[model samples]
Target: MTTATLGRLDAIDPAARRAPRYGGFSWTFLSVELKRLFRNSSVVIFTLIFPVAMLIMVGLPNKNVPISDVPVAQGGMSAAVPIMISMAVYGAMVASTMTGVTVAAERTQGWSRQLRLTPLNPVVYILVKVLCGLVLGGIAVLITLILGSALGITAPVGNLVLAGLLAWLSSLMMTSLGLAVGYAFPAQNAMRYLGPILPILSFMGGLFFPLALMPDGVQIAAKFTPVWGIANLSQSAIIGTAPDVWAIPNLVVWFLLFTGFAVLMFRRDTKRV
Candidate 1:
């Protein structure tokens, strides 16, 4: 072989220098996604700031007022305490679920095609997106908790920790629900549907209002909503009460259902491509 030809082959040789793998959980990608998310003014205001502001407005002024005949789970706890917990869950759910909306946008931009060309695993990509949502949700939770504490929404340390844990964990349901919605609909349509559905679900789940205060039929129906079980658990944590045994089944069933829906949608997309 000619010396020039040998040099050209050497320059192009895969054995000489390995191509960088794009697979796995990438911190660089994570950072980029986070920055992208934070840069969106709407996302920042809606997901991170709004919940805290709401708590301050509604909760701070009423911090000292004792809510009479609050629910059994609320025990002797001040109304502000339960409101803070619910808002934390509400914020976390919104933040995490909204992450799925990016999926719809990415699909519209053919980002999914670009992703398929890389070494990144599809599952890892999904996980990263979910993690981004979780991060935002966690930020909202922390901010709400800090503001609550500052505004005199007091609870035992253990109760605070438990409430946070339950609220955060329950947000996974919304994350999956968002993913399913994103995969099933166009970007604009996904958000449109979500805008109305979110508040409705939150209301039905008793995140915004107490199920105990609702009519008997509404209270019975609230049990079927995805947020109800987790909200109850969080409320019980704050009030130092035992969660109902039914809460376990409620959370598990809805989580699995949402997760399954997401998986089905993802698989359908893959088949189409």
Candidate 2:
């Protein structure tokens, strides 16, 4: 209030007056976001329940249809095994993408603006959201694995675990894609556009069927879809083969592309607010 008081306040270190910096990942924020996500009924149904249901419907019939006459230990697996893993990947993609899509709602509700006023770092906020998406994705994978096991899809524990992990991690690309879409479009429009595209991408990526079974032209184009590399790479763990050489590059390129777009859109959205 007074000049003397102002002088004393100014004399104190400026850093001490500043709000605490949340420079890195915030576990507390992650927990809060995860709880908020789980509370949403639609999220629970689509991300957790839908994949398992699909597995039961499509996978049950194929459970005993072996792809090769050899044993699972010799890199021979049941037809249902890849199908189950594909569903896990698909579920993870849906969960992570939906998690990113929530940003649009937050923006519309002024939540993003409010966050700017807190000590929460913007990057940390984004990181927390992405991690929340990944957590949901992981849950989807776990549920699928459990159902797959109950349905008699068997493999070595190590291979199954590795396949599940890859399926979970592969959804990271979709998290960025979701953020980019959420920041670029309205909440309603984001899902409206992305909802149909995911399955199409999955089909093109060979999640719904084997690329070998498709026509040659479709097979060639399948290699270019965003989901192809990750899907193939995840299945390779169970198939007991080295992943195609191009799989890693496809994933890296798409992830970087989505992330760069997300950053740009995020900055533009911030400016508008």
Candidate 3:
């Protein structure tokens, strides 16, 4: 070996050297999955096009009508930037979840078995796929936020960055949610069933609507929903209001629960095949 090569090898401690090999399966899976996504035109529609479209379809001009979940703003969708920004996030989450679940349906086509047969560990494969969802979801969130800003909707750029960061973090939690439900279905029809249902929940979750407009009891219930916590955390960033610190513990618990469920479900699915 060249002296430079010897020096490079010596510079890496044993732990550092072995870490990459240990994580190689996940890195390769992330790369290959990303390549597959880029090559597929239809996948583009689901992950990219649809998300952007949703933002424009509902968010742009936002001049059509206005409403506010906050009593102070009581109007239509076009009135409140916070509520408007949330609609984009809600749409993106629904789209991202549906996209992940549809990928699970490919499991029946022999592709799943073939991938599993490769050196990639099942856990690593799942992790990489989930991470891929995060990547696309983060992009979707950014586009939605930027669009919200451009359309007469305004906020401090710092506030916008904070909102964007919250959205990205929330997307990771959504990735786990998607994986758990997607794997649980074990087939495509479940995704079909799920495709429209969760978005409806968003209305109650206060995505584009205010809980204030709902019954007080119902509004209290909404506060407990996973998406509600996420949206609340994000809105706090936008309005420059401090988020309820309690939202953090609730979010952490939900993320952990969803992740655990996803692992259990994936393991069961693997054992069956």
Candidate 4:
């Protein structure tokens, strides 16, 4: 019952004796990925610099300018707060979505294929990416808020906190877009598309200018763009005013659409490998 049993047990197939691999989420992997992402100088520099620069340079001139014709639903914040909010949103969104560039590079290096050999589920992998992106985004948001405070951008404590939270949450939509591009294109080509496309989306979403100040057609079109809803929501939060009827629903729709699209593209890309 001792030596004989031990010999028989050792003779069993080593593969059969190994534990069954059930794919699931991994926080340890996510932590490593976050640390790796933070080490990228380009991402860290961009996230740290862009929003503060925009607030100081672009916002200072218009700090005291009241938005003359804002609707009742939109709050009564000065131009400065909206500018701070928009720039913060822009910085966070760009930083978060830029993770896709990393993802694209990983695909180029065959990392995605290697990921398939692990016990991590695909859904969990994407979620981890999104969470990492948000964490990076939060850094940008905090910096923007601090810079805004230094620049004398003021609001109620609750309003400031709410706007910062919304800005960070809205960045997830861009993260989805980035993941889609990474999976759908090579890294080099993905950056080519993303670099130009980001500012355009930012403009279209009314981050550069208030929708009320735009022409009616542009305002209508802005409602349908990916970033506008979150931007608007964040803006309203900063001003302590209600968002438009479409803001929350529009944000929800775009977030879901982009997220679903990313999942589908990732599955398709993985299947080919």
Error of 1 at 273 (Å): 3.7
lDDT of each candidate versus the true structure: 0.81, 0.84, 0.66, 0.84
TM-score for each model = 0.83, 0.88, 0.77, 0.87
Instruction: State, as a TM-score between 0 and 1, how close model 4 is to the true structure.
Output: 0.87
All models, RMSD in angstroms: 4.5, 3.2, 7.7, 4.9
lDDT of each residue in 1-273, candidate 3, tens digit only: 999999988897865533335434645667877787556566556665654565666556554444445332343334445754575466457545654664576666656666554554555656676677677677677666766666656656787788777766766666677777777776757666666767766776777677768898987887677777778877777767797776777678877887777777776666666
Cα lDDT tens digits for candidate 1, 33-90: 8888787677777876888888988777767766666642455467788888898998
Q: List the residue pairs that clash in candidate 1.
A: none
The residue-by-residue lDDT of candidate 2 on 1-273, one tens digit each, is: 999999988899957756655564557778888888888788778887889988998877887777888765566678888888899999999999998888888789897677655565555666677788888899999999998898788777888999899899866789888988998999779999899999999999999989989999998898888999899898898767788899889888988887778777887788677
Q: Residues 22-134, candidate 4, lDDT per residue (tens digit)?
A: 44656677789989898898989988988888888988787676765762235545678889989989998999989756889889889889976655566677787889889
Please count the clashing residue pairs in each candidate, in the order shown.
0, 0, 8, 0
- Name every residue pair that clashes in candidate 3: 66-75, 66-76, 66-77, 66-78, 67-75, 67-76, 67-77, 69-210
Q: TM-score of predicted model 1? A: 0.83
